[model samples]
Target: MRAFRVLSHAVLAVTALLAAAVPASAKGEDGAPTEAGTTFRTATAVKQGQKATASASAGDYLYWQFPAGAGQRPTATATVNLADVSARHGAATWRLDVFDGLRRRQPCASGEPEKKAGQQDSSVTLTCTLRTVRPWAERWSDDPLPGAYYLRLTVADGPEEDLGLPVRAEVEATAGDAGGAHAGGGELGAPLHAGAVAEPKDGWTGGWWSDRWLWTGGGALLAALAGIGGYTLTRHPHRFRSRPGAG
Candidate 1:
């Protein structure tokens, strides 16, 4: 009986560890590390519900990734160096999002995340604060679902320079869950290829700007021609007069 009791206790401990392994976000000591590091990038000038671009007027973005069914969350801390602030630039804000492959999940509130092992729901943890030296350090966390996940970062408008903002994201996770393996495969949450435009903002593009310029230039040229014709007719009365005065 004692031997059976010992085995049961061991099983319970292992279960408890596994239960806590998956988190919305976790620290380095708690998660797993991959040989292939996980990370992504974006612009600080990114606005809500808008795609990011590497435009001078825009800012910078950074993201982190985790493998599907790894049985752990991906979290990281990075340093952000801000410089060349613009008068129009607003406060530098940091954000986090979870993605199955490339499809981002909606922000989950406390105690309302997807189920993992023993927990009824998962969780998301984030910490953002400012630092001196024009550079800030940010730490992020997320309790990920049993599929591929990504952590995304954004700044309203970043500093000025190539590699303008020094942003680095480190990842950690815990692995091993036979149930997760049966839940689904890695293909479920696949990342989209480059050049995949999810959606555009305000229904405008570079082509639209070019067309506007063409129309404006054409209109100005037509107006100038009309004005010249009117002036000539008014200044030279004989030009339009009947030559012999018979008609």
Candidate 2:
């Protein structure tokens, strides 16, 4: 009996330590590091290739953010479990919006950014596949640049009763480098992110020169050659000769 008690206590102690080591948020069916933020500033940060999940009311907004480097295209896919089907009275629309670190909404290169789930359906999935992250882009352009990107998932329209009901959301964030073809030549004046930014592994340098500069230089050279030819053809031919055969 004494030996059995000692073994039992040791097992209990080890189990207690293991449970304490795991974060409370990770107790979900699928381990989630943290809860989704309600706003951009409070957005939960997820690492590249990592998945983030949260549970919130159907009416509440869920936000997650991930970092992307130049030359890589970032895509965010979210699966949302609507309120209990029995409580839902009608169809609901869910939207997934992606934004750069600057908070400018990024366009989805693929299909629609929203999905409609029927009242009988328990869940819906939405995805936002963004353009390739460019090394450098014009100031006025909203192109996806190297920096942090945010994901916002919210229920657009739903049954009145289901609005405040509990729901769960899961977001999978991934960034894949598309190679040099997608990267722009001109470097952005500044990264979209404020603090430490993710950069390409090979190295990224911008603001030096781009295809625009090359085009401009080529056009100028062609114009100069054209002007010189026109002058030569229209000018007095005898000006270069020695007085019409005196030579």
Candidate 3:
């Protein structure tokens, strides 16, 4: 009976530990905006390298905003997963456009401005990298704008038959050093809709602290300690009866 009780407690502890270690969902972590204005307003709060995923149909506009710190260049990559029904129509072409906070189109230094998914293919990917160009005035003007930048993904040209097919979209962004002192600083653009801002997790930088392995190890250690403590407390206590004549 004692052994059974110990075993039950051990199982419960393990189960609780595993439950606590599960990570939160990656999709919609940053509350991906469905429009341009909302995305521009919330882009500065999104951590670099955090990917956002969402489902949409053809003609639907998906937006992701990111901040390009002063002296930093921003780059974005998007991957689209098409439903099986999408192939029945024909080849589909997608467009990716980069815009500044003011909605002005910005040019990329590399990467295709458009991508196509063949009838036999189920996925397509596109990438864009933007650098700050020095304007003619003052020998240095941040043409790309260091504040908020947006990436707009849409079905520029696709078959009408697959217009309603579902698409799984994922976007990720990063910023690289531009070899100068950081200077640009400004407030985020006003949101066009209510509750457009998303508060990022505290101390989250998409860095070592967010690693899942570290959390898993910590949980395992706590579980082991709980198991040991349970076993010790459940064991029968030592007892002795004093002799009638003994002092």
Residues 126-169, candidate 2: write the lDDT tens digits: 98889888877777878888777888999898767777888888
Give each prediction's root-mean-square deviation over alpha carbons: 21.5, 8.6, 25.8
Best by TM-score: 2
Best by lDDT: 2
TM-scores for all candidates: the values are 0.27, 0.67, 0.55
Range of the 10 consecutive residues with the lowest summed lDDT in candidate 3 = 199-208
Query: Candidate 3 residues 1-247, lDDT tens each?
Result: 9999999999999999999898554335356432232244433234467777767777677777665543456788888888795345888898888886567788898887698888888789998988642211131433664345677888888788888788888777777654423223342243212122232222111112323455678889999999987777677333244667989
Positional deviation of residue 101's Cα in model 3 after best superposition, in angstroms = 0.9
Question: Which of candidates 2 and 3 reaches a greater TM-score?
Answer: 2
Q: How many backbone clashes does candidate 3 have?
A: 0
- Flag the better candidate by lDDT, 2 or 3: 2
Q: Choose 1 or 3, whichever is better by TM-score.
A: 3
Off by over 4 Å in 2: 1-32, 188-190, 194-247
Candidate 2, clashing residue pairs? 136-188
